[model samples]
Target: MILDILMTFGSARKNEDDCQFNGYLEDYLQLLDNREEHLQVLFQKVVEKYPNARICVGLRFAINKEVVSNQIIGYKDAFKLEGKALIRSL
Candidate 1:
């Protein structure tokens, strides 16, 4: 959905003169930040069920509380994840 929205704007005739679309993208990112707490809770639950499984969380570091690093699968920089609520075996 987001990619479609972005792509549509990129192809617009006045795309080079547009800033509204960029603002929309920032709003979308802000909404993601608002859900960070809820996502962190879900992440904890999954870690509990699979203690031995490798997991990685994603974040923008400087953008504190902006979003949970919820990309546990198919993520490359797993070690760069700095914060953790828990990592011990169950």
Candidate 2:
């Protein structure tokens, strides 16, 4: 089976409070899982929470110990596509 992972990273907005930012991150972390359903949920949540945040998503997979990876920046740009299409494009 091919395992897919979603990694989210970003900085808090200037006017944002640290507690709030940390809470958001904690929520994001809790939402992570190695399933398409979780990924779709994450996509929607991130879009709603961090519309202008600079987010990067990295995808990695291994084939015979050889790892292949790709990363995309800009939350809006990456999320423009839905579900599997987003993963494919990234």
Candidate 3:
């Protein structure tokens, strides 16, 4: 099963006209920064509802008409830390 969470900051017409690409980029980055927390919550909820299923987290972003996407099946075993530490190390 595929689940998607879509977030829109402003009207497409206005965003296209005003070239609000930077603002949208900022918002997307913020979302990415909080992705781990979001993923953890989603994993816990999904496991509760579908006990035997596997989980994967996908991330996507569009900026100035360019799109980028990636998926993570599971985290690395060596990465014992999270949040700011993980971000700072990278």
Candidate 4:
């Protein structure tokens, strides 16, 4: 769904000529950031049930490096994902 929304935004002819799409994308990312806490709860439950499971989560238009990097890295560490295993999961 996230990828589909990003692809739709990218493919729209209006977005090519208008800079407003950038703002829309930024807003969308912000919405994701806001909703992440609820997602984290679900993730924690899954990890608790499957202690050795490796998981990877990604966003299509993750423009904020600090937020995205911190979240993914946190997931990696908390989930005990390492090296080749992490890459393979991706």
Local error of candidate 3 at 1, Å?
A: 13
Candidate 1, overall lDDT? Answer: 0.38
- Stretches off by above 4 angstroms in model 3 are 1-35, 56-90
Q: Tens digits of per-residue lDDT for model 1 on 1-90?
A: 654453433211244422222333223333345548675566456556755333211211222343546564434354456644222232
Error of 1 at 83 (Å): 27
Q: Point out the higher-scoring one by lDDT: 2 or 3.
A: 2
Better of 1 and 4 by TM-score: 4
Candidates in descending lDDT order: 4, 2, 1, 3
lDDT of 4 by residue, 1-90 (tens): 654443443312243421123223223333345557775566556656765443222212323334556646555443443322321112
TM-score for each predicted model, relative to the true structure: 0.22, 0.22, 0.23, 0.26
lDDT of all the models against the reference? 0.38, 0.38, 0.34, 0.38
Per-residue alpha-carbon lDDT of model 3 for 11-78, expressed as tens digits?
23343321222222223333444547765565556556766543221222223212223343244332
Tell me the lDDT of candidate 2.
0.38
**Model 1, C-alpha of 14: deviation from truth (Å):** 43
Which ranges of candidate 2 are over 4 A from the true structure?
A: 1-35, 59-90
> Could you tell me which residue pairs clash in candidate 2?
none
Q: Model 4 scores what on Cα lDDT?
A: 0.38
